[model samples]
Target chain A: MKLGRLNHVGVATPSIERSVAIYRDRLGAEVVREPFDLPAQGVRVCFVDTPNSQIELIEPLGADSPILKFLERNPEGGQHHLCFEVSDIAQARDFFESGAVRILGPTRIGAHGTPIFFLHPKDMGGVLTEIMESPKQAH
Target chain B: MKLGRLNHVGVATPSIERSVAIYRDRLGAEVVREPFDLPAQGVRVCFVDTPNSQIELIEPLGADSPILKFLERNPEGGQHHLCFEVSDIAQARDFFESGAVRILGPTRIGAHGTPIFFLHPKDMGGVLTEIMESPKQAH
Candidate 1:
């Protein structure tokens, strides 16, 4: 698989509003985008930009949201996943297969219009790993 | 506090060598530094360079290491902390204090020569955050 770059780091939080304030007021990161509700995923997401990479703050909007259960177990805070920009999603899937890692999706368009797939946490140690087609606007 | 670019994202894993192979062979990240042991922290770290930030794969050197405990609970995989580079560690501590979040440390240098401090995970919704002075080479 041809890896392009580190896309963005997903952060799970109890409240997007609170996380936004902390990222902005404390960390000096600017809000690149406002919080958007993803009813399909049962969460709300906000993007913040630093000098290098973006931080995605996610808040569970429904009880059934996976992030909700994750927060319940962690309670403090934790990273959701590390997304890597890939040249080809299919090639990435093939690479994972060679390593015997389960691929969650072949290639699906996600929030940012990128074709992405997730490598099961069991294969990647404990962190959720993602491989996605490089964004046109990627640096 | 003047925010510098992100330095690295730390990931705890059972074996640094295995993680390194995946990152280097599959992700195309080059191993910029060899593994270094920090007895005080009970960790051995290897650094990989991404386009925007570095990835630090940490392995606990001893069974009593804090990372060992983390791996025991989160056997799947997860990020350890998000580290940001700052121009002044003291200023970063002051900035964190001005906010509602509690600071975990103040201007203490790490084994890597960067002065760092942590923000209490409670305020950040469980994400262990570190603010540090940019490494000499980074500056």
Candidate 2:
């Protein structure tokens, strides 16, 4: 699969507000998008834009949310996944399948409004990986 | 702290040889630096360059290595940390200190031969973060 760039590092957080402080007050970050809920994904997400990439802060929207389990494992929350861009989501998916690697599901419109799919953590050396369309602005 | 770029994502592995195939064969990575042991860090390390950043693969060097514990928790290996480049390591260290955040120690030479320091995971949203001097090739 042709990997494009490191788009963002997904950080699972118990509270996006607190996470914002770390990036803003601590790191002196200037640009942080407002937190928005993705009901379909069962999480509240926001983007902390940096020079090279983004820090994606994600908080569980409900008790049964997938992020809740991650939180349980790490109450302090942590780096949940690494997302890389790809020019072709379909080709990326096919490449994973051909290599006997598991893709979580069909590509769906992710928080960035871009085609995205997740690769199983087991297949990625225990690191959850996200493959997404590169440079998508929903234009 | 002036974050320069996402330099690399550190991945702890059981064996660099097995990890090489995942990057070279599966991900089509073209450039992978030779694996070398960092005795002081108690780990073997290598770099796999990507478009935006590189992947630093690290394996425990001996029984007493700190990574052995990480490997114990994650037998298949896992993402260890995220390293971001900083224009000035001293300024970054001061920034963290001014915020009452913990720094593992004073800056020391890292795998890249650049002055680097680690931020305690407890203070970094559960992600062990490395702040390093940007683009230092040690000429």
Candidate 3:
């Protein structure tokens, strides 16, 4: 359960293009990946690279999108979750379970193509948290 | 406004001590600052250090705390804002103003003892954002 870097902050956005504009045009961000769909995850995602971390702009893609409920609660969208890297996802999951922390679901391949699992907000200081294993290859 | 490092993600909490324990005992974070009150800001704060950025845990210190409304809505507390460093505070403020990105208030000294200002969530993709000058002396 050793904590590593703050990988990225997941931001739920109603429009990825508009969010990209804010990061690129308004914030003067130099690198922003084009929005791409992850059908399995039910979202379109764009990465806005900062000097040390990234802003993950996520827009719902389909009717059964996981973030649909969040968007319903916050029509304009907002910060969704915080993702942190761990050396090993298995150990992290085990630690959380042992400590009675609720894991939202099974570990799955995340947008980064690394194993990741979500922790319930109720167990994470009311903030949804994602624990991910550091990717072997640079992404 | 040129984006620098993702300085920190502010987390509003009901109890800084409980939040500190979650980061330390549960998340296995190695370094966490002792909670301290910032009377000027009307919140007690603590920092949970990650490798690249820190998590600022904030708790209301008095009746007139600015985050009182947010806490009322989310009684369990949650992520509050995202802070990014900028090289020049004056230029950053000007850029936001010229772009019609509402700045919440006059630039004031932040927890890091550097000039900082909050951006309206309406203009920031529904996420409250803090623009801060890179501190001359690291905190």
User: Could you say which candidate leads in TM-score?
Assistant: 3
Interface RMSD of each: 2.2, 1.5, 0.9
Best-fitting candidate, measured by lDDT? 3
Span of 10 residues, lowest total lDDT, candidate 3 chain A: A91-100
User: What stretches of model 2 exceed 4 Å from their correct place?
Assistant: A136-139, B136-139
**How do these models rank on lDDT, best leading?**
3, 2, 1
Which CAPRI tier for candidate 1? medium
Please, what are the lDDT tens digits per residue for candidate 2 over residues B60-116? 997788899999899988889988888888888888887768998678989988899
Clashing pairs in 3: none
- lDDT (Cα, tens digit) per residue for candidate 3, span B1-139: 6789999999999888888888888788999987788887888889899998999999998999998988999988999999999999999888888896889978888888799999999998999999999988764
lDDT score for candidate 1 against the true structure: 0.76
Residue-by-residue lDDT tens digits, candidate 2, A90-128: 888888888867889778888888899998888777788
- Give me candidate 3's interface root-mean-square deviation: 0.9
Instruction: Candidate 3: list runs displaced more than 4 Å.
Output: none
Q: Which ten residues in a row have the lowest lDDT in candidate 1 chain A?
A: A105-114
* lDDT head-to-head 2 vs 3, winner: 3
Clashes of 2: 0
Q: What ranking emerges by TM-score with the best candidate at the front?
A: 3, 2, 1
